[model samples]
Target: MRKPLQHIWALPVLAAGLAVPATAPAQSIDVTLVNGHPSIFLWVKHLTETFIPAVNTALEGTDYAINWSEAYGGSLAAVGGELEAVEVGLAEVAAIPTVFMPTQLPLQNVSYNTPFGPSDPRLVMESVAMLHDTVPGVEESWHEYDAEYLGGGFALDNYVLMTNFPVTSIEDLEGRRIAAPGPAVNWLEGTGAVGVSGNLTTYYNDIQTGVFDGVIVFPTAAAPARLHEVAPYVTITDFGAQYAGTLVANRTWFADQPEAVQNALRDAAAAYTEAYLVEQTDRVAAAMATIASDDDHLHVLAPEERTRWASALPDIAGVWAENANGMGLPGSEVLTAYIDALKAAGADLGRDWSQR
Candidate 1:
């Protein structure tokens, strides 16, 4: 739980008569926060509830303060356009989805390319932050677009399959169309299933209308969307938690801010990421429990089958790295470092993607 805010009046009553003429009005800094997703989404929700409030709290009783203007739900930027919005100064800060901007943020999608890594969102986020701090090209990727890379990001929970049919094994998916977002379409490459691109907004309808037999989605979203009512057969695919996006500040705006204001924004963003992970973990457990109650409708893929499915896929990670290398990015280095970090953290990886 987040700490409650402290009242401004609680500050000490004027340094024991060491007063100047009068209390100077606190500095008002106007900031615009952006995200393409609606506020109902955890990442954007936290930006409003946690991040913005945290920034306010940090500056309470101080000379610096924030006046936040929020734009979400594609008001200022649509999905996959957040980077552009922030780059062009349409917004001062934004939560940009790395998966959506593959060409611009190639190194940021290392986790998506190397699937079946770890289900722990915290581990993945921290690993990525470490890379941002230590790796050469990680931060540079953001600077190229006039945005500064914040240390943490929104990490999605483990992906599950909600389908119209039961998937006891990977072979059961032959001729089926499974909807996945962004690079996740690659996850279905060798499973004999056709992977169509889709997202949460259209998932329930698409499956219900037979547009796709199933959707590869996380439980946190599945439960609230009541996806089971439409696609009742739930398969815990455990494709692994993914680092979806990060909150970025416009580089010029951030550089021009006072050090104190900059620190407050950075701290608040970090807090937002931490709070989001805790909320997501609990929501995931509850969602899985709710869907699991209907035993007849739920199936946890067999371990051997999970491994078989993983081993069957083409070297998507290697290809991603090769593509990155072609762009003169340290593709192989980031891949090797990420896989090594996951191994050190004892991730039960179904496939070691960095070997290539």
Candidate 2:
């Protein structure tokens, strides 16, 4: 088993008011951690490196500490199984990518279709926080599923393409298999490209074994997976950097935690949010450098080709909203509010799906 990533030799003491109540003697608080993706994804790395260390630091003086067992590589929960895992108490804490469960977590799917908007991690995070705060009873969706969202957000660099062959125009992608998760596939519909179902773990082998021609994933993911070796063509789409993953714990497990442990978890969430963004932002530049000089064919998709993509995709917004509505989540309102917020933040409404 590989050790998780961590930074910081020491952490600052918390303010008096922020401290959790230390109650009872000889009580130990344990949290079982589950990650959906393999340990290779940047998001998982963030959980291990930045998030867990911060949680450990915050819980140093407390009787509560994470047992910190990783159920990675699908040993515990398979891909797209995280939400159910947490709900059933298979894991006390889990990082569930909402895009993976669009049918189950409709409320969380707001960010996936609200794309071509913000690529900045900071902006995405703030927007998500605002949605949780402003949207009516958005937090209750978790409870309905028997889970309590502790805290979760993704800080991803801009998304790009890693292909086995060079693609400078939209025509190059015609009929080519591009591995993408849920709503991401909707972006390719009507474009003559076939979207395959695959995650980061399956990507490397898929590319190497010719299972896919390329993958529509973030640069942060491409680098660590070493996809550059097999798929040499790197296209910078900058279409959007998705921010959708969130942490949820079994409500029963969370309620059983001592106040000190709860506080430690909260502090860890804050630290993870800050550090995750910083590392992800930095990875963009680092990945570019590595790709450019390292025998990878990097191509910046031209403006016209991007326009073709923006034009060819179906009206995913309305479809998504309707899907959520079917699931009894606040689909329509969440969609409208999220779009309005993005527009207020100065996002250009490139493709008018409202009319469609």
Model-by-model lDDT, in order? 0.87, 0.75
Predicted structure 1: lDDT? 0.87
TM-score of 1: 0.92
lDDT of 1 by residue, 51-167 (tens): 989889988877998888999988888888899998999999889888777778889999999888799999999998888888898888889899987667798999888889888
Per-residue lDDT of 1-356 in model 2, one digit per residue for the tens?
Answer: 64443323222234443577656764555567787678777677778897789878887766666667778768888878887888888888887778787777777767667555566767767777677778876778888778887775674666777788888777888989999877777777787789887778788899888889988887777777788888878887766767668777788888888887777776777777777788778778887777555544777766676767777777788888887778777788887777667667875444554445
Candidate 1 — worst ten consecutive residues by lDDT sum?
7-16
Model 1 residue 90 CA deviation in Å = 0.8
